[model samples]
Structure formats: C-alpha cells, structure tokens
Target: MFRLQFDLDRIIGTLEREGWVVIPNALSATITANLRTACLDMWRQGLFHEAATGRASGQACRAEIRADSVLWLDQVAALPAVQAYNAAMDDIMQAVNRGLYLGLVELESHFAVYPEGAFYKKHLDRFRDDDARTLTTVFYLNEGWPQQAGGQIRLYLDADCREFVDVGPEAGTLVLFLADRFWHEVLPARQQRLSVTGWYRRRRSSMPW
Candidate 1:
C-alpha cells in the first residue's frame, strides 16, 4: 500500500530556483550501512580509482567505471525503502518528459570518496550545446558528518557568478538538480566525504542514444 511519495512540483520548482534540492532519509540507515560495507569491500579489492580526470580535480576515491555499479543497489532494490528512491526518480522524469515530444530518459551513476583535504573544482555536469542531459543526482554516504569537516557542495545559479548555494554531505541525503543549470564544486573534506553522483538525460532526436 506504499504509493509513490514526494512533491514533484516542489522539487522541480526548487531545482529551477535554487539549482538543487536535498532529500533527507532517501534510504534507510540499515541499507546505507550495508552499502558502506559493500563499498569498503570493493575498495579493498582495488576496484576504484583515486581520481577522475576532467572538470573535477580532487584528492578523492572515484568509482565511475560503471553505472549503477554499487553492489548495494542491486541488493536493496527489493526493499520498499530502497525501491522508493527509484520510484521517485521515475516520477520526476515522467513529469519532465510529458511536455516534450519523443524525449527519452537516460541515466548513469558513480561514487566519489573525499578524504582529508579533498575537493573538486566547479563545473557543469553536462556537455554544452546539448540539452539532452536533463538532470543530475548525488547521493551522499557518511553518517554524522560535521560542519567543520568542510564537505559541502557550492552550487552556482547565476552566470555572472553572483548567486550560489551550499549543501552539506550529510548521510542518507540525495541532491538532484538540472545538469546544465548550475556550476558547482565540493569543498575540501577534512574527513572522508563519500557520495554517488550521476546524471539523467533526454534524447535530442529520434533513435536517441
């Protein structure tokens, strides 16, 4: 009897104005804990990279080798709490695609781990001149993160570099925003700052790739 939950209009409006919105407790603590364990195991096996060579430059662990690569996604999808995450996204995309003819939704995801003094430079998540990549989502993984830890995302909502918003990397929080609308960066983390960031796209034409 668990119907889809979340305010679609509010989220869209917030994204338009603030450039981002964070949803708290998007996943249960139990699942987050299990996912942390799974990621740690993978980390021990050397399955991730220490850097991503692009708009981001930071002393952080990156796991961008695969979309939905985290073992926990598959493991917890069956759980109602976890399934809500997917369902909410599906609803968000459906609403976005309704006004556009033949637009398609595509998604890719990865994880980033910011250790002491780790950070990323400001950049847009999509390729310019292409409006197909509609949005981006980042899920954070770190319990009881401190404000002094300095792991916050600084989001830009203006072209002249005047407007901005800062979001913290609190555990079980998910940040979603339009991909092209903002330029953002992660502040240096004093401790381990972990997150899974990704994008959702819409095809520009027929036979969309």
Candidate 2:
C-alpha cells in the first residue's frame, strides 16, 4: 500500500486557469499494475457489456455513436485494486472541494475497454436530466501504448470549442476536467485500449419514492 501524493497547488491552479489538466504517473506502479491485471481478468471473464448512451430510461446501445465495453465499479466489497484507487480518489475529492468549493459528494467509475477500431463520438459528461456530475476523470491502463496507436482522447478547448489537444492512453496517465466545460471524444485505436473512467458528482437531495 503506497501513500498517494499529488501536487495539489498545481492541479488546482491548472483547473482554475484552463479547466483541465493531464497528470502523468497519477497512480503508483504497484496500484497501476494491480488495476491493469484486474481489468484484464474481468475482460477475459466477459464481465463487460457494450456501453450505452443517455441516462436511465433513455439509455440505449448506439454502436455507431460509440463502440466500447464497460463494467461499472462496485462501491461495496470492491477488490483490493479498486479500493486503493477509490481511496486515492477520495483524497482528490477532498482537495477539489477545498480548492474549488464544488461540494462533490461521491464518485462513480467503470472499467472501459476499447478494442481495435472502437471509438466514441464527441460528447460532454453531463446529461441533460442530471446536473450532479461536476468533474470527469480518466486513468489509462494501457501499457506501452504506441504513439501510432490512435486511441487519443481529443479535447476541445475554451468556450468556442475551436482548439483541441490529443491525449494518448498511456499507463498511469490521468486526465481531469470540468464535466460540462469540455466536449471530448475517443479516437479509433489500432490496438486494445484500457482505462478507468469516473466522475465526481455534487450532492443531490433525496427524493421520495
């Protein structure tokens, strides 16, 4: 078990100025290795399902819009690797609340596998019916990902969404951004791509059944 240490000042500063940041070596080597193994095991066991778009009643599989498989993370009785990753995320949540005052209450994550030729269309993390999602985080688990692999995440910058940057899915690399502020997409890959994708949400009021 390794202690998680991040440059809080740098992260906050970047978020405040640019609305996003990419951090390399986000996870410790041990944790990253364990998570990669766990993801592979899950993939081999056929635990992942074809990812869908929309929310709740509106959710539907649209392969043309996006093609990938995903397995949502369980909060209770999670595996060791998941627990460690969650703990690290909790630390990040605390720091984010203190720095940005976003009132983030919880995190939800999933293991996503993008097989060769799979890609997701440009979209925002937040849904129309739900505004609780405040921040998006993605940690890559692909080891030795080549520059030519073509699984880069392209993020459109600023309000106009004119400029962009391509981020490779390299192992231990983490990308964080304001959920509604950016429109991003996953480009087609020449090889398999793996990642843990998650979102931090603002607290929601309880609704009566």
Candidate 3:
C-alpha cells in the first residue's frame, strides 16, 4: 500500500535523457495524507528550524536567499508515515543504483514549510564544498494547490539559465534532478506550502574537513 507510484523504467529513462523528471501522483493518496498530517503536527509542535544555506562554517540563515522552515526527517523517523516514505525512497535508491549506477547509498530528507510570500532564490542543489549529493528529490505535499495559488518550482534547463519549466506544488508530486546540474527555485506562494526535500548521497573517499 505504501509502494511508490512511479514507473521505474520511465523514471530511469527520463532522467538519463533529460537529467530531470517531474512525476505527478508519485505517492498514493493515503500516504500523501499521512505524510502531510505528520508534517503539520511537527510544525505545530515547533520542531522546525529556519532553513540555512552553504555548509558547515558557511551555513547561516539568510532570509534573502530562502525563507522556509525545516524539520529533518530523522527526527521523526519512528512515525509510520515517515517510515513508509523512507522505505519507498530506499527502493528508488536501489533501482537508481542498479539502472543509473549513481552509487547512491543513502537518503537524507526534511520536511519544509514555506509560509505565504516565502521563496527560495535560484540555486543548484550541490554545495560548493560538498559533492556527495548525487540526486535531488522534492516530494510535494500540498493538497488542492491551485495553479493560481502560485507556489511553483522553476527549473532552469540550460547552463545559460534560459530554457525552463514550472511545476506546481501539488500533493504526491515528486521532482527529481541531478544535484549538481540544474538550477531551480521556489516561487513565492500566496498561501502556505509543504514538501519533503531530500538528497541521495554516495560514499566519499575523503571529506573536505
């Protein structure tokens, strides 16, 4: 019942050809609703922290760059919904490693909440000092999000940042892209927005530290 809703072959093929893919209804309605409720409960409990940018010493909360709040999934891993989500991601990780040979070993995810007028400026997923992030995954949990409500993710297709695509923040929609390649950003929403954003990582021989 908690299985992923994506076509494994299609996902692999599209990512290989385009370096990115936006899949609608990537999760079942039951799982989506459970995850959404869990996220909201965490938010209400004040478990989220203001999102930051950069890495390690460079990490700082810069509202100018991003204004979302996040609660790391590990903090709520015991939750049934979170466990189901993790299991589903683990399946994808294995498939990707087998099909694309990305060498991804684990996934780290967080629940992100963007209040009204919140936005994240355009940026790539890989950090300047970190290259472990092999792939980026954004699983949206906003139910009944109308296009007019305005929280769309803008993905830049070319290095010149010209050609692009906009994906609505709809429930069960999942966006995947090569972490170091595409540039993307969240457009300001007229209302609140929610999502589980994560990165698939591979083992590194050495650390910058």
Which candidate comes out best when scored by lDDT? 3
TM-score of every candidate relative to the true structure? 0.72, 0.94, 0.97
Q: Write the per-residue lDDT of candidate 1 for residues 46-149, one digit (tens) a residue.
A: 66655543333332334332112233344335645345555555665676566333254755555566667777777787764456666788878788999999
lDDT for position 164 in model 2: 96
After superposition, the stretches of candidate 1 with alpha carbons farther than 4 Å from their true spots are 1-5, 16-19, 54-88, 95-104, 129-131, 204-209
Q: Model 2: residues >4 Å from true position, as ranges?
A: 75-77, 205-209
lDDT of 3 at 109: 98
Clashing pairs in 1: none
**Per-residue lDDT for 93 in model 3?**
90
* Model 3 misplaced regions, further than 4 Å: 205-209
lDDT of 3 at 188: 95
lDDT of 2 at 150: 99
lDDT of each: 0.64, 0.90, 0.93
**TM-score, prediction 1:** 0.72
